[model samples]
Target chain A: MTARRLPSGDFDVEQLTPGVRRPIKLRPWLIFAGVVVVAFFGLIFSRVSLDRSGFELDDLEEQIAIEEARRGDLRVEVARLQDPNRINAIAAEIGLVYPTVRIEIEVPGLDVEGIDPEFRWAQLKAVLTAQP
Target chain B: MVLGVAFVVAWAGIGFRIVRVQGFEADKHAERGEQQRVRTEALTAPRGTIYDRDGVELAVSIDAVTVTANPSHMEDPAAAARLLAPLVGVPKSVLKERFTKPDSQFAYIARRLESAQAQEIRDMVEETEMAGVYFTSEPKRIYPAGDLASQVIGFVRDDDMAGLEGLEWKYDEALAGTPGQQIVERDPYGNPIPQGEFVVDPAQPGADIILTIDREISSAAQQILAQAVKDYNALAGTVLVMDILTGEVLAMVNAPTFDPNDRSDANPEAYRNRAVTDVYEPGSTLKVVTLAAALEEGVVTPSSILKVPGTLEVGDKEYTDVGRTKAKKMSVAEIVAKSSNVGTILIQDLLGNEKHYEYLSAFGLGQVASGDLPGEASGRLENVRDWCDTTCGPSTAIGYRVDVTPLQMASVFSAIANDGVLVEPHVVREVISADGTRQRYEPTERPVVSEETARVMRVLLQGVVESGTGSRALVDLYTVGGKTGTTEKFVPGEGYSEEDRIASFIGIAPIDEPRIVVAIVLDSPSGETEDGSDMRFGGVSAAPVFAAIAEAALHRLGVPPNVR
Candidate 1:
């Protein structure tokens, strides 16, 4: 340690330790107060978000219940519409009656003609004519 | 020094309390706090739906609202009743009387209200600021097809919706699902708490059921049976239509049926599925069985000749043909076609007691047609050991001593239709669970007779429908075979009711291929029509019903008509 005097007669003291060193002052209580304030605000923000999400979950659940009720209503409606008696009544209302007779047509066997050039052309033309 | 001692004692008391709270009382306090917030809620699972073979909904469960109230908490009973009377469809006086009970903790205002009705009532109650009124979700059973197959589908009780009859009662457990529970922590005002202990046990839903019934055919048969009962002025009627191949009961319909939806107007008598539940003498229909047994034993052929007298004697009793005068030599097929009692008794006499009893047992007599249906009567077929005193042989031959259900008789014809293979009659086709797992039902089958004998029997039956007793049962554009039955109703105190006769006809359609068998029975049918036409004979009465139902069923199944 060394002391030096200026012209104004004020003495300045200096530390001469090996290597450059700076004396730093720290207020631990202030740092701790800053961290505590940050943490408290974060907790409040988190609680608000959680409460908001909880309300959102409740709303979603209520929506799901409503959808289920609507689905039940639709199912009941489908069942009502598919009733056979109703179908019969509607058929009768449309002036449609049950068929008293059923008929089935039998297909005749086919016989092939000669397959020359003119005959093939004639077969193709016949098919073309049958398209409509 | 004295003041210092008192301060020390106070400090010691505070320290002791802190230790007690932090140690032994801590768990107890924590449990009490959890109980204040944690609530157990029930999770209800939906019941299964019932469908027909082609996937049409027959019965279904729908959500409904049950309105309940704590009567003691009601501010004004009269006002509450007045507000809810019309909405709940309950009389205002009844509601007032129920709500006026001051000490009652809970009472049902209404059960199974429609969605709109429940919503209206809820809004009204909220608008009035009524207290202690609550609504809960209830599962309600609805049969959309109404009375189409009411007896087969049956009805469930309003309370708890438990099955009370028919297939509903038989497969109740399979259709009812398990309820689950959930426990979650809630705040003081009943809101769920975030980051709280929550647990859930999910509900397991019930399994669905698919029946073997054809809805269209069933509806058609029901309508035909109803019209028949009305037209003939009969007490009741039943029709059983089944596929001969798989023994699937397509339609089992009964007249005078009640709608299960509004069960208050339904009669308990109409609840019985007559085809399976009621028993009656099968009359001449059983003659086919006798002839079949005789042919199966190689004792007679279709062309075999038999000396059939007008009257035949057995023990001390005499059985006579309906309208015969003298002895006649007739072929076995001719005898069966005529439904001669003397010929059937001769066949029964040749079949003897032991073979006859064995044949009856083999034909599914004295046993229920096992299936999902409940309350089946096996009918009365006495064993030969207990038949010593009775004139069992001749009487049973003429279908007098034995009693059989319409289902059993239909099955007998179905056996002949299916080439002598008697398959068990069943209603349920498959049971499907919520997870898409299926449990299918396989029918039980047994061979009743040789195919050759069945073919011969088919030939004999064709004669009956073509030119014999059941000639009126002929269908256009198809070959038909059937047997007619006209039996006197047996009374308990009396021997038999001469006025009340059960007319029935069991028929197999498209006899060359034999796809379906239909049996129809009319109880106490009028002996004469309104125009003085005779309607007493089974061939005249029940055979036409058989024709109409068979025609509709065959067309619905897309069976091509091969007109002869």
Candidate 2:
């Protein structure tokens, strides 16, 4: 091996004497250890965020599923309430009459339903509360 | 040495074979593995949309959810059924029975759910883990304009939700688009994996239907008829409104209609489109046809004088006058206004039965309108040959044994309204494809009578509405022209029931321009009095209905106030 001069202007000829010992360098190992510790903490934080976001997505999807079901039921309800014979029969039972239009429904107390001031106010309140 | 050399060569050959097999099969094995994990997407066709003539939405389909289950996957089948019973509207025992075999793959746990119910269940699902339960997207049809124009629009079926009546039945194929397909590869666990690069086929949506029905005009006609039904105390009624110029029916209504969206509260009879299907012997309305035939054949003129008597005796049978009044000399127009049986029969004898048949055929009698319906009736016309020897010819001349649907009679009047041109009644405007491509249907026309004869007939009819039996059908804003038919319904063994009578009236509006033609018929009226014992005239019952309908329909159509 060719010897190179150091800043100390010294070059070693023998590798080491069996009896003679020197301390090990700690700079490279320490730098590598520091990088690994920082990487481990980053991984822990990332894992926590991924779990939390996945749960939120799951909750939103579940809510969407419920909404879809509700819409289907509304279809059934509209069909039921607007039925001609049913409405007419109800009107007859309540003695409510209608104009000649073919698709009219009359429930009992139809006039009251239309003109009752208290009922109208209740309707207004219901609308404000999104209950109607 | 030889054995060692042979072993070395064999080992090298074995090594090459292993590399060749593993390298070549790598792609094939990977593809097979991916297939096991892939899932398929099941896409259903979207329902078609319904619109009114004026670009208004009447019915539409909305997104929904349905819960289905694989009974075999449930660890506790009984428990699962009990849990799902309330949501599905089924008994827990029934669900348990379904899940008993465990071989039954899919059981519908619950069907279309409302938003609230879905929310409650979804909340429950999250609050409590309900595994092995799956939900899919479904669609439910909704009618925004509930029950409006229901008789014409018809209703869909319960099972497949197909249009079974009215325009719903006519353009079903066009409204229901061809369902497309999406073939998907599913895993053994039925879990879906999106093969992002794989081919996926989207479903074709149904085309939009455009009906020739005018909603406002229809409602207006209905309102008028409804009032008549009430005032007259008639059993059931029908109102048909048609554009005289185009022969396009603006609205046709039959009482006791059903909501298409909810068919549970409906009767099978409500599905009947009485405008074309129900036929009755059009009493005096038939007299107009007889009168038209005589005039068309030059057998009689408008000013021709007739010597009228209280009763006319023919072959030992006597037909009495409507009011038992004394004999009087009257013009042909006066005969129509007074509805004189003798006047009509005298002309019938002059025109001959053959001539009468010819006129009836021209007026769209003895045949169906041949519309979109598959089973339209021919209405009963036994070819004049079946006339009951003694009363046959005369009775027919006075409107008997010849059943006529309200629509057919309306078409005849519409011909008179349109100056002798008969136009076929059309409902469907176009048949469209899934991709918005459309094939249009044009209005069809045929000349039935001479313009001269039609003009004379119009004058006679207007006189009837203005001063005769149809005076009840007069509209204040416009001059109306029409005829009334009141006939006693014959009971088989009872001859003619005292109370059973069919009252009918048909009218044309704005006699100057002739816009709409309407007809109303009431069957089997109940109320009877001694003073007005024979008061079951079309004027008292059907004529008022015609009036109400004409008034409402004109207002709805935005007819300018120029009906002089």
Candidate 3:
């Protein structure tokens, strides 16, 4: 250290040589504190997402149950609508009656022998349509 | 010094209480809290559907609602009941009595209400600020076809939906699936808590059933049979239509049937499926077995000559033929066409008792004809060894001393129609499981007689329908064959009823290529037809029913008319 005096009578002190410097070291506690903070926030975020997904799943299950119930109701309604007695009553009200006399039309080459009944009916229909 | 000491004592007491609650009694308190938040709930498995052959629903289970109440929670029980009575279709007085029961915590207001109706009640409760009423989901069994095939389809209990009769009772296990369980944390409003503890074991749904019943044919048969029962003033009636090839029952109609949906005022007797459960003296229907045995044994041909008298004495009993007053030499076919008891008895003597028993057993008599139906009776058949030497053989030969259900008799005719192959009759066609696995019914088949013998028998039956006893069973534009049966109903505690008769007719249509066999049985049909024929006779009353049902069923089956 050196001191300089001037005419103003004030003394100024200055360091003539630089002092020895030390290397900075990272603190373990600080790093650990930072990691803990990130992990805590990550855990909280994941839990929130999981909870949201759970709520969505619950809602989806509830909707599925509701749709299934609706389907069952529709099925029951279809069955009730297809009731033969009700259809018969409706037909009767519309003045429909079974014919007292049935006319048998024999189509040439339309032999239904040995054919499946369902196929025979189809074939008969085709032949009848072709004739008309 | 005293104030300081008191403060210290209070602090010590507080510390001790905190330690005891946090450590010593923690498990009990934790469990109590868990009981409030974590709930174990039961998940209901859906019941199976009953569908007809055409995939039409006969019986179904729908989501319904049941209304219940915590009577103790209601502020004004009388007012709540009055408001709910009209909506629930219950009397206000009854609802009030249920709601006002002293210290009652729970009361059932209504069970199995339709969804729309339940929604209306729920809305009303919410709008009126009702506190006690609650609604929960339940399953309800409904028969959409109304009384059609009611006896065969059956019903379930209102509370739990357990099957009470018919196919429902028979396939209860297959129809009812395994229930599931869950452990879930829920909020105060019973909503599942997000991200809370939840574990679920899923329910397995029931198997679906496909029946052989044709809905259209069944409806027609029911209408016709109901009218016939009314027209003839009979006690009850049964009509069963079966496919000869597959042994699938197309339509089974029982008169006096109760609707399965609402059976509140239905007679208990109406729930009985007489075709499979009740037995009657088969009368001349049994004669087919005798004739088949005779033909199979080579003891008689269709043209074999027989001298038949009006009456034959066997032991202490007498057997006589209807509409025959004198002795006549007739062919075996003619005798069968005439339904002669004396002639059939002679043939039975030719066939012998042991051979007769063999044929009866082969025809599935005295055995439960079907395993698919519940409460089916194996019509009584005495073993040949147990047969009395005096009159057992003779009486059995003439269609006496034997009991048979209508289903059994239908099977008898089906065998002849199916080229003598006796296929076991069944109502269920297939069952489909929740996982789409299918189980189809494979009926048991046995050869009862040779094809040639069956053909001959068919011809003889055709003769009966052509010009003999079953002439009234002829259908328009179809060559049909059938047999007539008339028996004096034997009462259990009394002798044969003088006024009651069991009249029956079993027939096959398009006789050349047989397809369907229809059996009609009428109980105690009295009075006469318009032509003055005795209604008590099977040919007069029951045969006409057979004709109508056969014609309708054939048309529905799309069977081309063969008589042209």
The local distance difference test score of each candidate is: 0.86, 0.74, 0.91
* TM-score-superior candidate, 1 or 3: 3
After superposing candidate 3 on the true structure, give the runs of residues whose Cα lies further than 4 Å from its correct spot.
Answer: A1-60, A106-132, B1-15, B71-83, B92-104, B125-132
User: What TM-score does each of the candidates earn?
Assistant: 0.85, 0.72, 0.88
Which candidate wins on DockQ? 3
lDDT tens string, model 3, B1-564? 999999999999999998899889999899998999999999878889999999988989988878999998899999999999999999999999999888898899998877777778978999999998987788988888899999999888877778889999889888988899999999866788997889999888888999999999999999999999999889999999999999999999898988888788999999999999999999998899999999999999999998888788888988778878788998999988999889999999999999999999999999999989999999988999999987899889867888999999999999999999999999999999999999999999999999999999999999999988999999999999999999999999997999999999999997989999999999999998788888999999999999999999999999988887
Candidate 2 lDDT, B327-402, residue by residue in tens = 7888999989878887788778788877787788878888887566544677877786665656667878988878
Model 3 quality (TM-score): 0.88
How far residue B390's Cα lies from its native spot in candidate 2, in Å, is 5.2
What tens digits encode model 1's per-residue C-alpha lDDT throughout A17-128?
4566676757787898999999999999999898889878976985676467657766777877887778888999998896667543332222455557676667666765
lDDT by residue for model 3 (A1-132), tens: 597855543543323235745545669878988999999999999999998998899889876765676777778888999999999999999999898776666754456467677777786787778753
lDDT of 1 by residue, B420-477 (tens): 9999988999999989999999999999988988999998899999878898789887
Ranking by lDDT: 3, 1, 2
The lDDT, on a scale of 0 to 1, for candidate 3 is 0.91
Residue ranges of candidate 2 with Cα displaced over 4 Å: A1-132, B1-44, B70-106, B114-120, B127-129, B188-191, B196-198, B223-233, B384-390, B490-498, B528-535, B562-564
DockQ, per model, reads 0.34, 0.13, 0.49
Which pairs of residues clash in candidate 3, taking residues 3 or more apart in a chain or in different chains?
none
